[model samples]
Target: MPEVPQPVNDNTIKVRQLSHYQFSWVAGEPGQNGTYTLQLVLDQGAWEEVLTLTADDADALQDLLVNTSVVHYDVERRTLLFGVTPAGE
Candidate 1:
């Protein structure tokens, strides 16, 4: 009998929600390259890099923010929520 080769499989990338700017807006963790980006929807949607955070910045932001449905940035709070996910997604 001839030996058979096993099929190869690709790794699945799981997307976890990191932060929510609003019910209709949210953001995810930066990829391996340390760059945060957003993808828009349209006939030909595109991905845009909105911000780049250092290790310190990421730690600060993570500690200061939480998931919410109100997308606002106040001088008093000194926190900014950039819209990434589309409405009702």
Candidate 2:
């Protein structure tokens, strides 16, 4: 038998830096809900975490990422620049 996925209850992990991410969708059987899996690689590949989200939640996240402005890193300043302005400029 395949292993069942356990629910995450009162557990949290903080990711400071994200190196990579991947999204996966699994179709369910008749009268069942599909699954969305999000894999996150953090801290320059030091750690990896996987999250399972519902269809609504996944769509919300996708919309947020799609609508958000682009982010850039400043090589000279060594900081992340969000949008057109680098905070307090």
Best candidate according to lDDT? 2
Error of 2 at 32 (Å): 1.1
Backbone clashes in each candidate structure, one number apiece? 2, 0
**Error of model 1, residue 72, in angstroms:** 1.5
Write the residue-wise lDDT of candidate 1 on 1-89 in tens digits.
97645452221211223323211223545654444322212112221113456556655555555444433332233335444567799
The regions of model 2 sitting more than 4 angstroms off are: 1-14, 66-89
On TM-score, the candidate that comes out on top is: 2
**Regions of candidate 1 where Cα sits further than 4 Å from its true position:** 1-49, 67-89
Across residues 1-89, which tens digit of lDDT does each residue of candidate 2 receive? 97745663223333234456678999999999889987756556655667688988678766754555553333334333334555889
Question: What TM-score quantifies how close candidate 2 is to the native fold?
Answer: 0.53
